[model samples]
Target: MEGISRTYPGRMHIAAMHPSTQEKSWMTALQHLKRKGAIMALAFLSTTTLVSAAEVTYERLLNPEPGNWLTNNRTYDGNRYSPLDEINRDTVKGLKVAFTVPLAPPSVGAGSFSSSLQGTPLVEDGIMYMSDGWGRVYRIDMTKGDRGFINWIMDPQTDPEFATGILNNRGVALYGNNIYSLSPDGAFIATDKETGEVKFRVETQQNPAEYFSMAPLAINGKIIIGPAGGDGPMRGRLEARDPETGDLIWTFYTVPGEGEAGHETWENNAWETGGSATWVTGSFNVARNELVWGIGQPYPAYSPKERPGDNLYSNSTVALDADTGKLKWHFQYTPNDSWDFDEVGSQQLYNAKVNGEDQLLLGHFGRNGFFYNLDGTNGAYVNGEQYVDRVTWTKGLDPKTGKPVEYTPNGGVQTYLPETRLDASVFTTEGADKSYCPFIEGGVNMFPTTYSPRTKLVYGLAIQGCAFNQAAIPEDEYLTGSVSAVDTATGKVAKRLDLTSAPKGGAFSTAGGLVFGTSANGDLYALDDETLERVWTFNVGTMIDAPPMTFQINGKQYIAVAVGPGGVGMNFEKYPARAKDENAKSMANFQQASTLYVFSL
Candidate 1:
C-alpha cells in the first residue's frame, strides 16, 4: 500500500487508472469549465470595467444632437443658434412658462454674493445639466417634471480649496458617460453623467488666487479649460487634456514665452501675468480646424506703460489649431491698449460676403467700443467701425490694419491725475457724448453676441453711455472695460443697445426673425431682427449677465436664461438699478434669484 501511495497517491488516484473513471473525471472537469465560462460571461455583462474607454473627441464635444447645447456658445461660432424651429417667431409668441428650476445657492449659510443662475444650460434627451458661479452643478430630468427636479447636485463647497465662497462656475460640459465641471480653484473634475460621482480631478493650475471661471470647452477628444485670474500675477493659459484618462495633451499660453514673437510686448517679462484669458466660452470653426478665443486685457489692467506696444496676444482674437495649440492667426483689436479695453467677449463666427466675395467672418464688439470683422481663416481685417457714439480715444478704425486712428484724441487719451492708487471705480471714461447708450461701467464685460443666419446679420445689444471724471489709477487698474457688437459687413452701427445705466445680460438671436437679451432690471425682451426693435418683453424679476439659451424638447420649444446679478454692472454703488427693491436686504445684497426659468408656448 505504501508503495502504491508513493507511485500514484490513494484510492482516488487508483480510480483514474480505469478508463471509465477517467472519462467520468473528464466530464466533471468539462462541467466545471462550463460554469467558469458562464461566470465570466455574467461579469462581462454586469460591469463596465474595461480600461479602454472611448475618448471625447473635439467633434463630439462641440456638436451634439439637434436639441443638445454641447458648448458655451451653442455652436463654436458663438452664434447660440438652435436648428430646432419649433419655437419659431410665429410660435415663440405662444410660448408659456414650461418650468422653472430654482437653483438657489447650495447654502444660505455660506457668504456669497447672491447670484442668479448664470449657466445657459445644455438640454438633451430629457436631461438638463447646469452650474452656478458657486461651483454647484445640478442634473435635472426635463421629461419627468412640470418643474425640473434635481437628479444630482455637486457643490463646490465640498472642495476645501473652493471654500472661499467667491468662485463662480458658469456651467459644465458633457461627453460620453461623463460630465465635466471646472472648479474655481482651477481643478477640472469629471463626474459620471448619470450619477454625478467624481471620476477624476485634474488640476489645471496651481494658484488658488487664480479663479477658474470659464465653462470647459470639450473639443476633439480634448478638454479645453482656461483660467480667470486676469486681475492677478498669474498669466492666462488654456489646457487640452485627454478626456478619458485626464492626461495633459497640450497647453497654450495667452502670453508668449521667452524668445517668442510677442515677448517684446511685455515689460520686464511681466507678460508672465498678462491677462489674455478666455473668460467667456470660445467658438469652434469646424471647417477651419480652429478654435478661436479672445484674450483679456494686459495685467495691472489700467496701465499701458508697464506693458508697451500692442501686447501681441492681449486684446486680440486669435485662431488656434485645435489639435496643436499653434497660433494660426490673430487680429489685435487694440494695440498698445491704454484704456484696458480687452477683446474678452464672444467671437462670433459667420459666413458673409466680403468685398463681394464669400468669406468666413468673425464679428467682435470689443470693450474699446468698436465693432470688428476679421477673416476667420487668416485673421485678416475686413472691416472695423465704431459702433458707439462716445468713443473718445480714436474717431475710427483703419479697416486694413484694424487699428484705430487717433485724429482727435491725439492728446485726448484719458490719463492718471496723480495720487490716485489703483482705484477701479475712479477709472471711468470721461468724454463728451450724444446718446451714449451703454455706460462705461456698463460697457460689455465678458458677455456673448448673437449672429443671425437668415438676415446675415449679427444682432448685438450695445451699451451706449459715457463716463466722466474718471480718476486715473496705475496702468493696470484702469483696463477693465465693457462689451458691444458691430456689423461685420458694413462696419456700420447696425444697432447699439447700451446697458451702462442699467442691468443688462448677453445677446441671443434666432432664425425665427427674433433677437433676445436681458437687463439688470430683470426684463427679458425680443427684438425684430430687421429693425432691432423691442417686440416682446417679460419681467423675470432678476438682474442677469450670462447669455440665454433656446432649445426644443418633446416637440415643444423653450428659451432658457441664466439669471444672475452682481459683477461689474451689479456694483450698485456705481450702476444703480432704475428702481431698488425695498424688500431686498441691502442693495449690495440685492441678490438675483439663481434660477433657470424655461418658457415655451
Candidate 2:
C-alpha cells in the first residue's frame, strides 16, 4: 500500500512517510489519523445531533437545549438555570478537577495592573468562548483532550485607561459563526468563530470617556448592548445593531432628553449628564417581543441634589420594543436614589401563578434591598418585599405600586427616611454622618441571579452592610453577603445562606436540586436548592468572583468557573469582621490572576 500525507489549512498536518520506513511509521501514521478522525467525527456528531451545536439561532437562544450555555445568563430570559442533571447533587461530591488553564494578563498596555476573569463563558459545539476584563476573547476546544486546549485568543486592543475599576466586561455573545464582544473603550467587535479573526469593529460611543463593559445580547438578527460609566459624567443609552454588519439599527437613551418622555424629571439640564447606565445584560421576553434592562444610579452617585425630581429613568427597569427600540413601560425602584443604590442588576423573566392566575413576571432584587415582582407585559407592579436583613432607606415599598414608601410622585430632591439618606450637609459641612443599610455596592450589583422553574425559586447574592456617609471622611462600613432563595409568587425570601465572607459571585441552579456558587474565598459550593444547605465545597486556591456554569461534552458533564479576584475584592478592608475568617482572609490576601477551572464527575 502507498503511504500518503495531507495537510489541512490552519490545522495539524499529517507526517510525511518514507518508503524505506513505511512499515513502522505507516502504522503510527494510521493511528494518528484514526485519532484525529475520531475527534472530527465527535465534533461532526455534536454539531449535527445537538441543537445548540448546529447554529446560534433565535429559536435556540430563546430555548437553549440542555448542556449548552448560549448566552451570558444561559437563556434569553436571564434565568441562568440549566436543565442538565448529569452532575447532580448526588454526583457533585465526586466531582474532580478536570483541568486548569492559566490565562495571561491582558496585553502590556491593556490597563492598570488590575485584571480579572469576570466573564461567564459560553459553550457551544464543544467550543468554549470567554472574555477577560480587558475584552480579549478566547476560544478553547474541549473535545481535544482530558484537558481542553486554547484554540485562539482575539484581543480587541481596547484602551488601557477604560479597563480600570469595576467596569470590566462580564462576558461575550455568540451568533451565527461569529462571536460579538463590546470593548471597554466602546468598540463593538464581531470575530470569526473558526479562525478568531476580527470581522468588523464599530464605535458605539462618541465620548472618549464612555465605554461598554457588558456582553452584547444577540436576538432576532439584532445585537443589543448598553453603555457603562455612570459613576462619571456620561449619559447612558442602549443600542441595537445589525449582527452581521455591525451597523446601528436603533438607539434608546436610558436617561430621556429634553422634550422627551421622563425628561422633565431632571431640573437643570441634568438629563444631558444623567448617569442611568445599563451596566448588565438584560432579559428578553420572546412572546411579548420586548426587552427589559436595569438602569444604574444617576450622575454623581451619592448626591441626588445635583439632579431633582424622581430622576425618572434612573434606578429603574425599562421595557422597550425589541425591534423598534421604543420604550414600552418603566418602573422606578428608587426615586432620586442618593445611596449609590443602582438598580442595574439583571432582570429575570418567568411565568408564574400570581394572585391565583398564571402571569408573566419580571423579577429583580434591587441594590436598595427590595425584591420586586412586576407584570412583565406592562411593567405594572405586582408584588414587592425586602429580601435582605437590613433596609433602612425606606420603611418599606408601597404595596400597590412597588415604589419605596417614602417616594413622592414627581418629588424633588428626595430625602427618603431622612436618617438613612446621605447627609446633604456633606455638600457643605463635614460633621453629620448618615448611616444606611445595604451599603453602597448594593443588595446586588452586576452579578446576575438565577431562577429555576423546577424549584420555582429565585437565587441571588445579597450584600448586607451599613455605611456611614460623612462629608469628607471615608465612609465607615461593615458588610457581609448571603445567598438567598426567594419564592416567585410571594416575593419573600424563602431561605438564606450567609457566607462568613462577602460574596461577589453569582449562582447557577440546575434541575437536579442543586444551586452552585463561588465565595470571595475561592471555595466552590454546591447547596441544596430546596433547603439552602451546603452539600459540597472545594477550595480553588484563589478568589472567585465570577459565576459558575454547567455544560456537557461527549455525554459527560462538567462545571466551569473563572477564578481570580479584584472587582469588589479590593474592598476587603471595608468589611473587617466578615473577612476575619481564615478562608476569607486568605482569599483577601491572594493576588489577582486569570484562571479557568473545570471540574467533572
Candidate 3:
C-alpha cells in the first residue's frame, strides 16, 4: 500500500481505500490526463500563425498611377517619358506656369544657387518631393488645396559653412519607410517622407575640402553612395550600406588596390587616390542583380601624370554584383583619362530586342563625347558611336575593345612641362593646362543625356567647342572630353547636334515623341523625338546644369527643371564667343538663385 501510495494523486487521496482500489484512482488520473491533453490540443488549434516573410515586387515600385513618377528617369527605361497624354503635343503649347517658388540669394559666396534647383522632383500618390539648390527638401501636397499647397519644408541648411555653394542635391530616394538624402558635406540623412521629421543622419564621406552633393540611391534595402572629390587628391570609391542602420555592406573602389587585378594600371599608389567616385545616381536591374553606375575620372582636373595606366574603372560603366559589391565587368569609355569627363553620367538600364534576342542594355552619354549601349549582363560592348563633331582624339572606338586606341595611350598628363607646381616636401605633383579637348571642366559639365525607348533613339545635347590647352603628357594619358551619341542597334551616329553652348542639365526624352533639355543660355527646348527638331522652348533667365524631370498630376502633364548659375555654362553666357578678354574668367560672375519652377497644361 505504501509503495502504491507513492504514485497516488495528491488531490484524489482515498486514505481508507484498499490497494486494489488504487486502480480506480489510476482511472481517475487517466481521465485527468485525457482532459489536459484535450485542453492542450484545443489551445494549439486556437492559434494560427504564418511563417513566410513579406515580398516586395517591382509592380509595387512602379505604380500604375499616371500621377506617379516611379523611377529616376521617370521610368526604369530612362526615357524620362510620361504617358500622361492629357497635356499632349496639342495642349503643351498652352502650358502655363502653374506655380513658382521665388528665390533669394542664400549667403554671399555660397556659390550661385541662382536658379540652381537641380533636383528632379518625385511625385507619389499626391505628394511631390523636390530638392532646392541649397539641399532644402520641400514636400508639396498635390491634393491639399484645390491647386495644391506646401505641406511642409525640410531645411537641411544648419551649417552654412559646409555648403559647397551649389545646392546640387538631385533628389531623394524613397525606400520602405524612410527617405534618404546626401548633404553638401557628405552626410547621408534619413527623414520620414510622410512627416518632415529627421530619422537619422550619418556621414557617408568625411572631407571638409572635398564636398559630397548627391541624392541617396537605394537598391535592395541598401543605400549606395560615393564621394565627389574630383578636385582633391583622393581616389573615389563606391559604397553600399544599410539604409536603416548605417552599416557598410561592401565597397568597390574605382581604382584597384594592392595586388588586385587592375592595380597594375596605376602609377605608384596613385590608384589609392584615383578619382572614379560616382557623384550622380545609379540604376539597378533586379532580374540580373547588377547595379550599373558610371565612374568619374581620376582628379587633379588637368594632370594625368600623377595617375597612370588606363585607370581601369575610371570613365567606365561598371556592372557590380549587387549582393557582394564585386565588379563583374566594366567597359571603359576613356582610359588613362585626364579630362574631367567622368563616366559618372546617370546610367540607364533597359531591355529590348537586339539580334532577335532579348538583351539587357545600359546606356549613357559619356562626358568624353560618345553614346554607348552595352550588354548589361556582362558589360559587353554591343553598340557604340560618336555623337559629336569635334572628337579629335580618335577616329572612333574599336567595337571589340570599346576603347579609343590613340586616345587610350596618352592620358593628357602634360608631363612635358617642367615640375612647376611640385611640392617636393610632400612628394606631391600638380601640373597646369595638361588636358586635351574637354578639359576636366567637361565639354558638358555634370549634365546627363536620356535614351528614349519609344523612339529607339538616344537624345543628347552636346557642346561643339574645343578646349584651348592640352597636356602633351604621353600616349598613355588618354584625356579627351566632349558629348556624343550612338545608335544602339548599329552603334552609329544617326545625327550629331552640336551646340555653341556646352550641354548642361541632362537630356530628357518622352514617349510623346519629345525630348526635353536645358541649355547654358537659360533656354529649355523640347525636341521631336523622331526628327530631333525643336518643338517648344522656354527661357528661365539663368543657366541650367540640372537634369529636367517630368510627371503627370491630376491628368495634367507637368515639366520641371532646376536652374543654377555660376556653372561652367555661365562662363559662356557672360562671355560669349566675341567677349574681348584673353584672360577671361572661365567661371562667370557668381550669383545665388534658389527656386523651383513648375509648368503644366
Candidate 4:
C-alpha cells in the first residue's frame, strides 16, 4: 500500500494504490492503467454518436482563447499575460485553494540528484498536462473545479544507470495530437495527448554531459529544442525537428565553429566547451518570423580569465529565422562576463510607440542587473537601465550603444571595474571571498518574468543584494528581495518593492489587475498590477520553484502554480548571512515534495 499511500494533504490520494515495493528505487510508478483502460472500454460500449474533441492546431495556438492556457507562456510573444478578468482585484480577496494534486515522489536512487518540479503546467479545455522530473507526463482531468483526477501517466522509462542527475524539466509543448517534452537524459519524447501513449522517442544527447531541460518550443510544424548541461565541457546547439517523426530539420550551434562568422570572438579554442545554454523557453515574434531566444554565459563560470575574448552568442539574444533555424541577428548583453551572468531569462516581446511610431520591441530583465528594450526585428539595442539598486560590475552602461562604458571594442579579455573582478581570489589558486554586486545567481536567471499589457510594466522577481565579505551595505538592506516594475517604453523602473525573503519563484499577470508571484519561503501572493501592493497571500509551508500561470474554465478563472523546493539556492548557504532574511533560516529545514496547486475565486 506504500506506492499510492503518499496521500494528498488530508485523505488518501484519489489516484491509485500500490505496495511498499513501489517506493524502493524511486517512487513506485503506480500506473493507473486500469482506470484509463476502463474509460476506453466504456467508450466502445456506448453506441450514441460521439464527436471527437478539438485538436491543438497551429491556428488555435496562434490565437489562443482566454479560457485556456495553450502554451507555457500562454502566447508566442511570452507576455505571460492573461486577458481573463473574472477574478479582478475586488473578487481576488475571496480566492481560495480549489484543488491540489501530488506528483510522483522524486527519485533519490543511485544516479539521481534530488528531482523536483520546476516546470509550468499547460491547461487545455479543462485538462492539465504536466510532467515530473523523471519525464513522467501526467494527464489530469480538471473538469471538476473542486478536485483533479489523474486520468493517465506516460513514463519515458529512462535508464537508471545513465539517468541524468538534474531531472528538472521546464515544461512540455503541445502541437496537433501530440504533447512533446525532452527527458533530462536527452530523449525527445512525443506522447499522444489523449491516451498517454508515447508516439516517438529520439535520442538527442551527443554525450553523457549533454542533457536537456528546456521545454520544446512548438511553432507550426516544427518543434525547437536545445541541449543543456552547458556548465560541463560540451558544445551547445539548438535543433529544429519534425513534430510528427522527431527527425532533425536544421541545427544552429550557439558557439560558432572554426571559420564561422563569430568564431574569432573566442580565443584559445575556448568555443569548444563554451556554455551558452538555452535552458529556458523564449518568445516568437510572429510578424517578424523570428524566434527570439536568450543564451547563457560561457563555461568555467566566474572565471572568464580561462576563456578570452567576447563570447559572441553567450549572454546574447539571438533572433533566428524561425522556419530555417538560421541566425538573423544577435545582441550580446555581457561581454567576457565573469560573474556567472547567464542571460537565459525572459525575452518578452511587446509592441510600443517609439517617437510617435509603433515598433515591435523585445524587453528583458537581464541577469547582469539591467532592464533592456531591444528592437525585436533586428536585435538592435534601443534603451535599457539598471533595475537593481547596487551594481559594481561597471560604472554604467553607455547611453547610446547600451554597452558598458568600460567595455572595450575588439578586446579579447575584458577588465571592467577591476576591483569587482575575481582578483586572484578563487579563480586563481586556492580560495578567497570576493565582493560583487547582484549575487552570482544574478538579477534573474531562467525564472519567467511578467509583462502586463494593461499597466505597460514588466515585473521581475529581482535579488537586490551583493556577495563577498568586504562589501559595505546598510544593516537593513544587506541582502534582500525586490520586485522591479520596469516601464516597457523607457526601460526605466517605475516601482520597486523590497520584500523580506527572496522571491525566487516566478510570476505572471492577468487582466484582473493582479500580478501573482511566489517567494522562496513558500509563499504565493498576488499584487495590484499598478500599485504593486500585496492583495493576497497563501503559504503552502514549502518553498516554491516554479512560476504561477492563469487559466479559465466553466466561465470561471483559475490561478495555478507548481509548489516544492526540490532545487537549491532557496536558502543562502553559499554567501554568509548579513541581515537575517525572513524565511532563509527555516526554509532550509522544510520538507521537499512535488505538488500542483490551483486556485479560484
Candidate 5:
C-alpha cells in the first residue's frame, strides 16, 4: 500500500506529439507504460483503499462547495469572490499566518524575461495544487491544518533555451483523474492526481515566440489553452482540446485568416502574424454556454500605422461558444490601438440592475483606462466611464456608441490625441508638452479585478498615473496606484482608495465583507468591502505579484497567495529620479522568494 504503483493508467502515445529529437525517449516511456499499466492498475485498486480523489465534474465547478477552490477564479465568473465567511470583518483582526510551503526556485533562466509567482493556487478537498514559474506542479497535503507537506511533485523539465518569453506559469487545472498544466515552452502535460505519474504530454508550442503563461481552464470535458508573446511576430490562437486524451477539438485564431469574417481589417498580409494573444484565464457562463475571453494588443503595439483599419479582435473581449470554439460576439475596447494597451485581462460576468432593469453584463477594466459594461448576450455597449485619474488618448467615450470621441467613421487609421500617441506625422508644441495619460499599462493590465455580488461593486486595482513618450517629461506626469470600486449598476466609481504602491498583485473579495490585495512592495492587507478602508495588514518580506485566494478547510477559512519579488516591472529594474513618491521609493527594495503563505483567524 505504501508504494503500490505509479504507472500511468490507460496511458496514451500519440504519433508526432513531441519534437523529433525526443521521440525515441518518449516511445521508450510509452512502452513502459503499456507494459506495466495493466498490472499496476490492479495493484492500485487492491491496496490500502488509498484511492484517488473524485473527478471534478462540471456541476461541481458550477456550484462548488464553499470549502473547495475548484477552478481558476473559483467558479468561472472571473469574480475572485469567495462565499466563505469564517474570517469576517469582526474576525479578520485576529488573522495571522497559519503555515508556509516553499516551492521551486524562483525566476530561473527560463526566458529573456525573469519569472515570478503570477499564479493563483488551486485547492481541493484537503490537498493543494499549484505550479511554480518553471511549470513544476506541487501537490501539498493540507489536511493537517497545522502545516502542509509536499506529497509529490511533477516536473515537465522545460528547456529554458527554448522558452523565449516570460517564465510565469500561472497555475494548473484538475479534471477527471489528472492535473493539467503547460510548460514554459508550451507542452501540455497531464499528471495522475494520486501517484504523480504523467499520463500524457502534448507539444503545444508552434514557434519560439509563442509561449504558455496562463493556467489552463477546464470546463465541460475540454481544456482551453492559448499562448502569450503577442508583442512579437506571432499570430495568436485559442485551442480547445479533449481533456482525457489531449486531442485537439477546435481552434479560434485571434487574427482572422484571409477568408475569415474579420480578415478585411488588415490591409496587407499582416493577419498572418498580427498579434492578438490570448494570455489570461477566461470566464465561463454555464447557463449561456459561453466562454468570455479578452484579447491582447496588435503587433507593433505602439505604432498602429503599420497595420491600418480598426484591428478586428485586438484590444477586445470576444465571447465564444464553449462547445465549438466559435466566436459569438466581440467588443473592441481600443480600436487601432497605439498605446501598448493589451486588454488581455479578465472579462468578469455578472448580473446587475441597470436603469431599473436587470441585465446580464460583461464588465472590464480596460487597459486603455476605462470601465465598461456591455450586454452579455450580444456584446452591445451598455455603459462606460473613465476610472483612472485621466485618459489622454481620447477625450472620452461617446455617450451613444461608447466609441472614442476622436474615432473616425471609416478611416483606415485612428488619430486619438496625437500629442499622447506615437505618430510620425504629428508636429505641435502641445504634442511635446505631454506624453501619455493613465500610462500604457492602463487603469489595469493583466492583474485581475474582482466583482463582489455582496457589494454589487466591481473593484479594479489600477496604476493611476501617466507615462512619458520617448523620455519627454511633464512635471505632472507620475505613476501611482488606486483601487477603484465601480458601481456595477451605474458604471461609475463608487469609491477610489489611493495606495502607496502600484498593485501589480491583484485583488479578491469575500462574503466576509472584505477585499484582500497585495502591493508591489511586500504588504498584503484586507479592506472593508464597502468603505475600502484597510482593516488588517501583513508584509510577507517579499513582493506579492499574484492574486490572493481563500478556501475553507475543516470549518476554518484560510487566505492564500503565491509570492515572490522580481517581475517585469519598473520596480524590478533600476529607474531614474522622475517621480519619487512612497509608491516609487518602496518598490525600490524587495527580497526574492517563491512561497505559499496561508493565513487564518
Candidate 6:
C-alpha cells in the first residue's frame, strides 16, 4: 500500500492519443505530481516503478535475496536451507504466533474426508503465496506489522470428484507478473499477481482420468511440470511449457516406448501403462544445464509379478538436458521394485567431500531405505549406505555399482534377498500372507529432506518399523517414523530421533545450527542440527504435513508451516492397535483443517 498508486492521471486523454503520445502524457503527469509537495508520495511511486512485474528472473531464482523464498525448495539446488539465523536456537524459544490464516473451505459436495496442506509457502518481498488442497491460491501481505491480511484468493474451481483420494495441492510458482498453478483435473492456469485474474488456462493432460498435484518448477523462462496418478494406471512424463504463453516446448517420457533403449525392460506391454509418475518437484543444476528428477514405481504397485525386468527409469533418478528434454544419464536405485518404494522424492544437489575427494554430488534419502551419493555430472554411482535401521530388501548395495549386492545383470525377474521379497504365493489363485520390513508406506515418502552446508549433514523424516505385505490386505499394522541426521562425507546416520507415529512432514535446516520439523501428533520441533537433539517443541493441536520455511519481513525473521491432516499421515487409523500408542492416539483425536501458523520472536 505504501508504494502503490490509486490512480494515473490523463488516462481518458491518453486513451485517444497515439502510442508515443500516450507514453509522453503519462511521463508528464508523473513529473507534475512530483513537482508538487508530495515527496513521500513521489518516493513511493519511484519505488513501485522500480519494482517491475517481471521481477522473478533466472538470476534471482538462482541467488534469491535473504528474505525471499522463490521456489519450493527455496533455491534451484533444492537444499531447503535458509541463510537467516535470527531465529536460531538462542532465540527460537522466544517464538510466538505472529499470525494465522485459515485456508478456504474444500469444494462443495466433497465427501467428509479431511483436507491436507502439503505445500511449502513461497514468500517474496513481504508477500506470501500458497495454495490449498483444492488448488485455491492465496496471496497474503505479511508487511502488516505483527499480523498479515489475505490480499487475494484465486480458486481454480477444481472438481473434487476428479481427484482419486484426499485432495492435496503442493503450492504454486511465481514468474514475471503471473502465478502458475495446477488443478486436480489437469488444468494449468496462470493468474495476474495483482488482481488474481486468470490470464490463460491450458489443459496439460487430455485424458480425463489423469491429474496433477505437485507444483510447477520455473526455470530459465520455462515452466517444467511433472504428472501425478501413480496410484492408478499412468505413464510418467515431464513436459516444459513457455511461461509467458503456455505453449508446449518439449516432453520427456520416463518409461521409454517401443524401439527406445529401455523398452525391453517391460513385458506384456507394461511400458504403456507404467506407473512411474513424476509426482514430486525436482531440482536443477545450473552449471551443467541439466534437470535432475526422481521417478516413481512401476504399475500394479504391490504385484511385481505382473511386470518384470529392472524397470528402467522407475525407482531411479534421471538427468536430462534442460533445453532438449533428452536423457543425459540415469541411476536406478530399485530394479523390479516389489515394495512400492517410489524414488520420486526431492534430490539435493551440493558439493561435498566423498572418500577423501571433493565432488559435486546428488544426494537422496530413498524410500527403499538407502542414502545415495551419485556423480552429479553423469549420474554414475559414487557411494551408498543404509540410512534406516531395518533394511531387509538387500544385504547392502554393491560398493562399485551401487546396486543391491545380489543384483543379477539383465535378469528378467529379480528375487534379491529372497527373505525380504513379497511372498510369491500371496498373489496366486490360492493366496497366502507374507510379512516384510520397510512396508509399502516406505522408509520415506515425498516429504523432502534438507541439507545444511554449515553442518555438512542431511536431515530427513523416515518411517520406521516393518509391515506384512499381502494382496488386497492392509499394510498399516506396523509403522512409525524417525528424524535422522546423516553425515554426507561417510553415508552413515550420525544421530536419530524416533517417533511414535508415521511422519508425513519434512525437515528444514538453517545456518543457525537448527533443524525445524513437525510430527503427526501436532508437535512442531526445533532440533540441534549437529546433535539432532530436540531444543524446542510446540503443539499446534493438528497434524503437519508440509515443510517449514523461514523469511524476514521488516528485518524481523519469521518461521511458518502449514498444519492440517489426512494424507498418508492418516494411514495409522487403519490399524486399531495404533490406539494403544499415545502419540498415534493423540493425533487421531484431532481433525484436519487448512490452517497456516507463523511464529516470530
Top candidate (lDDT): 5
Locate the minimum summed-lDDT window of 10 residues in model 4.
1-10
Where's the lowest-lDDT run of ten residues in candidate 3? 38-47
Model 4 TM-score, 2 decimals: 0.88
Q: Per-residue lDDT tens digits of candidate 6, residues 235-290?
A: 88998888876778888888899888898898878888888888789999999999
Residue lDDT tens for model 2, 1-601: 0011111122222223233575557445644553232111011011211122466888888778787898988988899988888878788789888998887653322333455677799998568999887777777888643776676677655556544435457889988888888767676778777766566666566554476778889999898887787877888899888887787888899888877898889987788888888878888888888888999888877677778888778899999999899999999888888888888887999988887999989999888888899999888999867877888888888898887777778558886788766634333454356667776667887787999888899998877665553343343333567998889998888889987666767888998889998766667899989998899898876667789999988877889998766544654332323453644444445666778899988
Cα-based TM-score, every candidate: 0.79, 0.87, 0.78, 0.88, 0.89, 0.87
Better of 1 and 5 by TM-score: 5
Worst 10 residues of 2 by lDDT: 38-47
Per-structure clash totals for the candidates:
53, 0, 33, 3, 0, 0
Ranking by TM-score: 5, 4, 2, 6, 1, 3
Itemize residue pairs with steric clashes in candidate 2: none
Q: List all candidate RMSDs to the true structure.
A: 14.2, 9.6, 17.9, 7.0, 6.8, 9.9
What stretches of model 1 exceed 4 Å from their correct place? 1-63, 106-116, 158-166, 407-442, 468-487, 495-503, 572-590
Give candidate 4 misplaced runs (Cα > 4 Å): 1-52, 109-112, 160-165, 423-431, 469-479, 570-583
**Candidate 2 global CA lDDT score:** 0.76
**249-354 in candidate 5: lDDT tens per residue?**
8889999987887888876677877889988888988888899999999887766888887887999899999989899999988888877789988789999999
Clashing pairs in 6: none
Score each candidate by Cα lDDT: 0.62, 0.76, 0.59, 0.77, 0.79, 0.75
lDDT score, residue 269, model 5?
Answer: 71
